[model samples]
Target: MAGLLAAMTVSLTGTRVSAIALPWFVLTTTGSPAQTGVVAFAEMAPYVLVKALAGPLVDRVGPRRISWVGDVVSATAAGTVVLLHALDLLPLGALVTLVAVVGAARGPGDLAKEIMIPEAAERGRVPLERATGLMGVTERLAQTAGPAAGGAMVALLGPLAGLAISVTCFALGSMIVAWALPRGMGHSAPAQEAPEAGQKGQEAGQEGYWRRFGQGFTFLRGEPLLLSVVVMVGITNLLDAAFSQVLVFVWARESGHDAAVVGLNSSVAGATAVGGSLVAAAVAHRMRRRPVFFVAFLLAGPTRFLVLAVDAPVWAMVTVFAVGGFAAGFLNPILGAISYERVPRHLLGRVNALRDSLAWAGIPLGGLVGGAAVVAAGLTPVLLAGGAAYALTTSLTGLRPEWRQLDRPRRTGPSVVPAPRERAGTTDGGRAERSP
Candidate 1:
């Protein structure tokens, strides 16, 4: 667990830093908001596409192996960008290509690491809620530290230096996973064949990749609760992408604070999130899932955009984001616990991949849409519209029937009744009696 957390921290921190550096670099270099959106789209489009497809492979090959390979690939891709830029050989086309490669590698890598958490938590004998809360802590802390570091580096040494540091982090993360953990840690036994259905020719052969994919989709189809969660998460993620990738960037430029203010705001939000996750980890199980989740979304979503929509001081912006971030921290632990409890362990990889991919499918489009929207409608209007949309979506979704599942206890069935001894023909003395 330590090794996994450490590796995740390092890898995610670097990624977050790069997330800041990449856009700032684009905004500064190209000076076209549309191109900033284009680069963001180029990277994440492949991320969603590859992640949707990599689940079967992650399950078959084992997550640990895949995780290490993904980190190595990310490191290589990041390093290539650094080297090419240093050598003056990187054009916009080449840069986009490399970023896309990094994104593709990260999709499987991040998913593989996520798949390891349940196993890790089980081995540690920690409650799934607490374990996932701790996971949230790690992520929040990384988000806290990464942007601050990235901003500092970009401010001092330029964007290339931040990219260089990102490569180093990825390399170190790969090494930690490769060398620090025991072998076969996250590997699973071969997947069992699915039961034959009545359909002609479908049951005659080993299941193909598409068949396995179908199995996951079929499983989700039966789960209305999970489906509702997925849709809600997808819409929120889209709004979040718009805010983070485009709206925030444009606002920073307009506000004339740029990287420093962006980093400061992001860091504060992340730092507060760490505290929130800690509180959640300690008390989440004792709390009701529904109201807590709904209220958190209400507090976290839309408020940031709405605050940023008007002219406000930097402190006001920070305060709003901090409130949002703190509320946001409690969310994933609940969601993760629910997901881990509901899904079969063997299908974790495929099901998680499918769910996450569908949820994240809107992200690439977010940057594209935000950029185009800004070009068409301008920044403040876009921010206003986004906030209103977030509020409406979250509010409307709370009224859903399926959303009630979040409030239910983890065990859905009635308590088991004790069998009568006479019915079993057994004595209370624990001896079997002869039947007449």
Candidate 2:
């Protein structure tokens, strides 16, 4: 368990470094915020589009293999960026294309890490929810340390050096996961045997990797509860993505704060994320996960932008950003636990990626649109509109009948069907077969 956590932290640190270096790379080269936005979009577009397709592949190949492959590819891509910049051969268009390639490879990598968590927990005998909470904490820690580490590394050693550090961490994360995680091919315990391999994965509600990817689309089409959750998150993601980077820079510069504070602003938010994650770690095991989730989703939406619109004093800005960042911490774990509780293991990978792909679809759009909006709308009004949109989306859609399921006790066991409320009606499998 400790090993898993450590591996995740290392992976998260690499993620942190990339966030800092990628933007700096574009900004330094182009001297244009719009171009930076393009870089962000280029990377995320592939990430979202490819992740939608990668989940079934992860499941088919097994997450262990997929994760290792993802790590190796990601490391090479990150390393490529470092080499290009170091050799002074970096071209703007080529750099964006390279980052996008990194983004494409990262789809499976990110999903592989996610898929590994619950499986690792099952193997290690730790509670599934707790393991996911640790993943959240790892992300919070990464955010807390990522920007500062990236900034310092880039400032002192250059962005190429920062990318190199990210590459090393990615490689290390992949290697550790491959070595440490147990195989789930029914060894010590059968636990549950899924569909037979090479059976086309389409029978019994399954499909081949490519076929299963298509099936995920069908599966999610009518599920309003899951769909709404995906939509609400997608909207917020777009909003946040648009404003997240620009807002801080605009806030610091507009307020005439020190050049040093420009970077520190993100750090403050990262710090607060650690606090929020600690809270998530504490309450993550509770049965009633919905109230906190509902509340966090509703609150975190506008609060992020309201603080931005006010353009508070630098200290005040930092405080609010910190609060918002902390609030955001609850999101990933809560959603992950729900996914674990709700989704069947057989289809975990494809569905996980598909759903996440939906939520992330707007991320690149946000990055691109925000950059253009800044020129036309100015940062303040754009921020104001983004905040309002966030609140409206959350309030409008979350109050639905399907969403009620999130509040109910989730179905459990190793089956796809709902758990019987009363013991009398229970059966051996998901179906209502007679107890002979």
Error of 2 at 181 (Å): 1.5
What is the TM-score (0 to 1) of candidate 2? 0.84
> Per-candidate RMSD vs. true structure?
10.7, 7.1
Task: Report clash pairs, candidate 2.
Answer: 201-206, 201-207, 202-206, 202-207
Q: Tell me the TM-score of each prediction against the true structure.
A: 0.84, 0.84
| Cα lDDT of model 1 by residue, 1-436, tens digit | 7788888889988888898788888788789877887788788888778988887777667789989999999999999988887798888999899999999998889888877887788677877778778878877887778877898899999887888889988999999999976685877413222222333223322346776666667766667777777878888888887888789999988877777787678777778888888988888978988899889888888898898889689889899889978888888888777777766655666777888888876766777799899999999999999999999987898888777767663432112111111111000000000000
Question: Which residue pairs come into collision in candidate 1?
Answer: none
Model 1: residues >4 Å from true position, as ranges? Answer: 23-37, 189-206, 249-263, 309-314, 371-382, 409-436
lDDT values for all models: 0.76, 0.67
Off by over 4 Å in 2: 26-38, 84-94, 185-192, 195-207, 258-262, 371-380, 412-436
